[model samples]
Target: MRVMEAALVMMSGEAVVVEAPSVAAGFEALYEAEYAAMVRLARGLVDTTEQAEEIVQDAYTKVFDRWNSLKEPGGYLRTAVVNGSRSELRKREVRRRIGLDRPLDSGPDERDHMVDALAKLSPNRKTALVLRFYADLPEKEIAELMGVRPGTVKSTISRALAELRKEIDR
Candidate 1:
């Protein structure tokens, strides 16, 4: 475990050194350890690497802002990234409707066949598949993150796997 120097503060005109380890160090370690995986997870939702990295960074910023209050930082960060990606998709949809967005890039070498197929799924199904398979999260956890019941997650995962198999078999 890494420990960073605590800070000193003046309380009632008295100087006191805080004993707690630095949140900045903790967050930095977490960022270093998880950034790549989080980016990949975000990519599963957002498609483009640049968009995925942006989503992850945005999510990390949000998570860092609320770090002290978060009971489960990992879960909180994952939910934030997922929510951020969903928000990005909504914005992209709006841009597409307004004809402000470019056509989605598509080329054999530029895309992962499996990931591309996953991206073609409905949003909820894609989230279910990514959380369950890519993140290795349990069904209950996925349900909570997606705001659905456990049964819904089960069915969603089942259907998503079946769909993926069909795509891969083609």
Candidate 2:
């Protein structure tokens, strides 16, 4: 059984075979492989599971919209998720500043010190830490995703780790 059809064309005298995966088929495979991981990535960067799911869904919609044009769909999807998470955090901050945000009353059983410390971090620091630790991304890749220099990513991660240590110590 052929998964994709190969076409042969003659450039000079020798024939060249070219095979292309169907857009829908490729996208389905990508979604199946990356959906869970993408959601996890988003969850690390966002406040709630619901927001993570929404961010991932929106990223998938964006990836599917430009699937054929993307050179690297996975990278595009990652960038989209990071951007979406950043936007969500900014909106949340705006609401908090405007007194439109409500506080969560977590029981002692649900309160996680590390999570609380992470939430207290600035968005850039939080993003740098999440991408470095949770995603296990290299400084270069994290820099690319965060649109910063590798040196900046290095310093950000260092400072974030120090801050996390201080926060958790308290």
Candidate 3:
């Protein structure tokens, strides 16, 4: 009976000692695996690579905090990075609207203008565009992430592209 009790204790102790991966370790793996791709994705959504880097880092921090709850961590992180870049762009637009800041550049080919045009769009449209173009996600994936129908994603992308065309023509 004593030997049986000792065996149970040893088994339970070993079970308790088996640890899951740490959040930091998970985040590091995610960062290493996706950082460059995220930066490139963000660069298309933001004005500069520096801003893109900052946005990606902010997204990673958020992912770190919510790692355990994430089902598809990579997809979540990508969406978070896109959302973070969009948020930064929105802040810049607000500043521009309030006369708190000047347009960063006037170059026609510069991404700043493209980002500015995107900022003028509705959040849903902007999100759709980012997910479809920058993230290279399919319409179904964009709809899934945006919590909308695939038809809505299609319409949003159409409108966003029209807006971009008008901006480019200016």
Candidate 4:
């Protein structure tokens, strides 16, 4: 019953109105609006820009697949991005352990102090800190996205900040 109107231009310069179902239209709008932010979120969690882009694309695909039934598409998409980033990190760790991947040789002085400090934190702590500070999400929302209790998020962030302070002081 819900419809969205879009304008299409003909080769001859005539304009025509097209009606799309609200579901598809809504998804299109969401993709346009949140794609950049989602990429940034993934970038915060992942090591490379390419990986962040891939993770965000995968998240969008998952969101598109279940858009109609989703209760909160934005939140679901965010969770998907976070999960994808976590999976990628896990795969990289396995590769490193199996000798298929070499450790990055960049020295601490070559990177921004804050970024280096964050990279040294455990995945959970880094994720909590990124979601809370970089993404600027509230604690409750971060808890839902990270699939942990709010109290756990609070503690993780507290520990992460302490660790960051110590790392930066060096």
Candidate 5:
């Protein structure tokens, strides 16, 4: 029994040391692998690419800290990136309300005007639009994410597009 206890202690020590070495390396690999995708995802949420990159970096750091708890680290990273981007966007909106008008680069495509118009929508509508159009997610998936029925997603998208069309025509 004494020998078995000593072996367990030795194994635990070795496990800690082994995990220590891999943690940093694992984070670096995850950072490199997901950096661009996260940034792109963020940019679609917020205005500037630089802000998107910063948010993605922040999300990756959070992911690193909770790496072991994540069953799918990639999904966790994506959620973090999305949350960070939304936070930044909300901050920018507050700043705008206070008269801090930063110059925004309107996206190069004409369709972006539609998206920009969509940004004026309520948060739920905007999220539904971005998920449905930008992410190309099906209405069913978006409904699940937004905790609404699929019909709600469809109606929201339809209403959002109608509003966009009015804005564009005017």
Candidate 6:
């Protein structure tokens, strides 16, 4: 199969190519497979679609640059995207503080309500919840990506769910 058509092996959380798995080919296949997902995860952090897109693009570029050295491209790429997104948000916050750009607060839409609720969560809870619910990752993989233990993932998810319920009921 062509690199673009390769089936991904993700059960154990690695993106494996069914074919030759050349560096370029494997990276290409994995990029096609996970780019949208990485963007979505980034979207949960950054304000605009453009910012999230740029972050994902940068993350993919870095992953491709280091593809030959990566032991687990899938996990590494995911962690990179999350890290990039957080960094973008921080930089954006600084820009807004110094008046480089206007604040992003418009009236809250329905989605904004969810975003508002998630914003109130500690970064730890928010990351775990987003990965578990939005990305549909297994706990083991989320733990690896978040650099936490499996038990921590479980408790984080549990606490986050409870907190979200409280926010929703408010």
TM-scores of all predicted structures: 0.74, 0.82, 0.71, 0.79, 0.70, 0.69
Which digits, one per residue and each the tens of the lDDT, describe model 6 over residues 58-163?
9888887677789999888888988887676566667766999775664556356777777666667877888888778899988887788999999999999899
Q: Judged by TM-score, which candidate is best?
A: 2
lDDT of 3 by residue, 7-82 (tens): 3565753653322446546666777889999999887777678998998888887876677798878988877877
State the local distance difference test value for candidate 3.
0.75
Which prediction has more favorable TM-score, 5 or 6?
A: 5
Of 4 and 5, the candidate ranking higher by TM-score: 4
**Top-down TM-score ranking:** 2, 4, 1, 3, 5, 6
Clashes of each: 0, 0, 0, 0, 0, 0
lDDT of 1 by residue, 1-170 (tens): 33233234325566664434657676777788889998998887776889999999998988777777878888888888888887877777678779998747767787777877876676778888988987899999888898899999999899999998888878
Give the per-residue lDDT of model 5 (tens digit) for 1-170. Answer: 23224335756537533344455566667877878977887777777788888998898778866877878787778768767866776776788788996646575663466666766765566667787788888998777666689999999989987877787787
Clashing pairs in 2: none
Residue-level error in angstroms, candidate 2, position 126 = 0.5
Considering TM-score, which of the candidate structures 3 and 6 is the better prediction for this target?
Answer: 3
lDDT of 2 at 100: 98
- Report every candidate's CA lDDT: 0.80, 0.85, 0.75, 0.82, 0.73, 0.78
- Range of the 10 consecutive residues with the lowest summed lDDT in candidate 2: 1-10
**1 versus 5: better lDDT goes to:** 1
- Any residue pairs clashing in model 5, and if so which? none
Better of 1 and 3 by lDDT: 1
Question: What is the lDDT ranking, best to worst?
Answer: 2, 4, 1, 6, 3, 5
